[model samples]
Target: MRVTVLGTGAMGAGVAQSLLREGHEVTVWNRSPERAAPLGGHGATVATDAATAVERAEVVLLTLFDTDAVVDVLEQAAGDAPTDAVWVQCSTVGVEGTETVVQLAEKYGITLVEAMMLGTKAPAEQGKLTMLAAGPAEVLERIDPVLRAIGAKTVRAGARVGDGTALKLAANAWIASITAATGQSLAVARALGIDPALFLQAIDGTASDSAYAHTKGESMLAGEYSAQFALDGLRKDIGLITDSARATGVSTTLLDALGRVYADASAAGHGSDDIAAVGTAFTKD
Candidate 1:
């Protein structure tokens, strides 16, 4: 497959590397060309412009920050995409945003698939993330091998544009809510002189154990703030979840509260740190 990956950020670069390892011809483009440097040595061609990146690719993958960024890139590449090419949207945009992308792709006669991933950069680079996919059945089948190369599992949400986005938002809401609760509980435990490790062990012993909890708990205990996923990015995802829930007349009090915590973390200068740094927001010396 000739693949073009837009927005060469952490996840984008990971996606590109995964595809390259699978023997696909990969082209990478970022608004800041400097960001594409790490991918260049990995057999990826860096595109000087967005349009040039999409011109020759059979599949275009988007892993941008938000809906607006996705739109901006697509608009810039409007004239360069081949009519039969498939546009795989792997960003974590909300329901409305996904719908808009569907419309734009239809207008341009491009096959569009909403593909939202369910893990961070490490898993992405290892081709071990889970993909929530929704779009035309044939299109999904056509891209199954490429998706499988980059994800451990590909769950078909439905054959509709926004279904995958909706599922991703719902999954992220659980992630944000659970992470917030874990951070607050750990803060209380530490203040009461309970060892963080002991608390984590007990929690992992129960049904409450989860991958996010374990990973983030270990990071909290070690004070490792590496940006596997950044605070601001998680904040944006939480906002998208809450907004989508509200638009659909669903209640999301827990997600709303988590969004506040993320916003506070961002405002307190931890925005660039890993999202697990949310623990620092509640910790008191």
Candidate 2:
């Protein structure tokens, strides 16, 4: 497949690498040209500009920072984009932003797929991501190989444009809540003069235990917060979830409170750190 990817950040670069490994014709562009540099050695065409990148591909993948970036890049590329091209938007652009992307797709006569990547750097690089996909069946079938190349499993959330983003919100909220609880759990364990590992041991055989608990708990213990999924993106996800809930008159009491913790962590020095660094929020408090 002839593929163009915009925004070669951690996730984007991983996706492009995996696609190239699968022998796809890959073209990539990034706001910071250096991020896309290593991909050039991996058989990808490093595009000079966003529009130049889009002109030659049958599939366009976006993994940008936010909806605004996604919109801005697509607009820049729209002038040269193929009208019948399929755009698999792999960014988690929130509920409202998903709708906006859909409108843009309609306006430009392009097939749009709302694709939500449900893992971080390692999973992305290893092609072990769980993909939440929502879009037309025909377009999905057209790009199933590319989807398979990037994910361990691909689940179709729905046929509507924004359904994948909604599923992404649910998954992200679950992850944030777990990380927050883990922070509190370890903090309480330590303050009470109990080894944090004892808490890990206690939960080890229980249903309440999770892989995330172990992963983030170890990060807490080692004080290693190198980003797999950065705290900033988690903060954004929290805000996105709360806003979406409020839009439908749903209660976001807990999520709203969690949002503040993540926001404060972002305001502190942990924005670029791992999402597990939220453990610092509880420990410091």
Candidate 3:
């Protein structure tokens, strides 16, 4: 597959590398050339612009930040890309944004698959991410090789373009909730002069145990805030989650509160750090 990946940020870069490892001809572009430049050494052809990147692409993956970035890049590159090429929309741009993407695909006559990724940088780098996909059976079958190169599993949300986006938002709502809840428990334990490690110990073999707790909890304990998934990125996703929840009458009470915690963490200069930095919100004076 000749794959072109736009927006080579942390996640996007990993996705590109994973494709390269699978022996696909990969072309990458980023607004900041330096980010994409690194992939050149790893067997990816770094394009000078989005338009050039998709000219020979068999599949174009939009791994950009938000709806606006995705829209901007697609508009710039659509004319140059093959109409038969599959555009895998992998950004977590919520349900409303997916509708906009669907319209763009129609306007340009491009085949689109709404495929939102699950898992952070590590999973993306290892080709272990779960892909929540929604599109026609034939289109998905056509891009199965591309999907296999980037994800460990492809979960079919439905045939409708927005179905994958809806499922992605629901899954992200749980991610934000559990990460915040884990941070709170750890913070409260230390505040009460209890060993936070003991909290992990207590839940080690219980029904309440979660692998994610230990992943983020240990990072919080060590204050190693290097981003696997940046706090600000999760903050953006939380806002999308709240908006989707409110629209569906799903009660944004918990999500709204969690959003505030992430907002505070971002405001406190931890925006570029790991989501474990949310623990600071509970401990701050």
Candidate 4:
């Protein structure tokens, strides 16, 4: 498979490397061209421009920061990619943006596959991402190798543009809620003079314990929120979930509250830090 990957940030760059490892010819393009350079060591062809990257590729993956970036890059690549080339959108643009991007696909006459990845940097590098995909079966069939190389498992959410993004929003809302809950539990333990380690021992192997709680809780206790996933990105996902929930009449009570907590963390200058730094929100002013 010949693949063109746009947006070579941590996640995108990792994904491009995964495709190259699978022995697919990969072309990578980023707004900042320097970010795409590191992939060259792995035999990736660095494109001078986005359009040049898409020109000869059978598959194009979009891992940009948001809907607008995806739109801008796709508009630049639209005319160059073949009509039958499957354009897999792996970014998390919420419901409204999903609709607009679907229109953009029609405008460009490319097969659009809404495939949202469920893991961050590490998983992308390891090729363990769960692909929550939605598109025509014919389209997916044409690009199965590309999706399989990027994700360990490919789940077909449904055959619509917004279906996969909707699932991603709900999943991220739960992630935000649980991540906040994990931090609060750690804070409560500290207030009571209980070692957070002891608290984990109490919940260990119980139904109340989850791998996320354990992993992120350890990071919180150690005061290490390195950017596996940045706080600002989580804030963006939270806001996207809240916006979608409101438009669909789903109560935003929990989602909005978590959004504020992440907002506070961002305001406190931890936006570049990992979301595990959410623990800081509880202890700081």
- How would you encode candidate 2's per-residue C-alpha lDDT over 1-285 as one tens digit per residue? 899989998899999988888889999999999999899999999999999999988989999989999899978887687877889888887988888888887788777887789999988888889999998888888989889988999999999888899899999999999988988899999999989878888899798889899999889888899999999988988889999999999899999889888887887899999998898888664
lDDT for 23 (candidate 3): 91
TM-score, prediction 3: 0.98
Error of 1 at 200 (Å): 0.7
Misplaced by over 4 Å in model 2 are none
RMSD of each: 1.2, 1.1, 0.9, 1.0
lDDT of 4: 0.88
Pairs of colliding residues, candidate 2? none
lDDT of model number 3:
0.92
What is the clash count of model 1?
Answer: 0
- Please name the candidate that would achieve the greatest lDDT relative to the true structure: 3
TM-score of each: 0.97, 0.97, 0.98, 0.98
Q: Is candidate 1 or candidate 3 better by lDDT?
A: 3
Model 3 over residues 176-264: C-alpha lDDT tens digits? 88888989999889989989988888998799999998899899889899999999999999988888888878988898899899999
Compute the lDDT for candidate 1. Answer: 0.87
- Candidate 4 lDDT over residue span 22-102, tens digit each: 989999999998899989988999999999999988989999999999999988989998777889999988988888899
For model 2, state the Cα shift of residue 18 in Å.
1.1
Where model 4 places Cα greater than 4 Å from the true spot, the runs are none
Ranked by TM-score from best down, the candidates are 3, 4, 2, 1
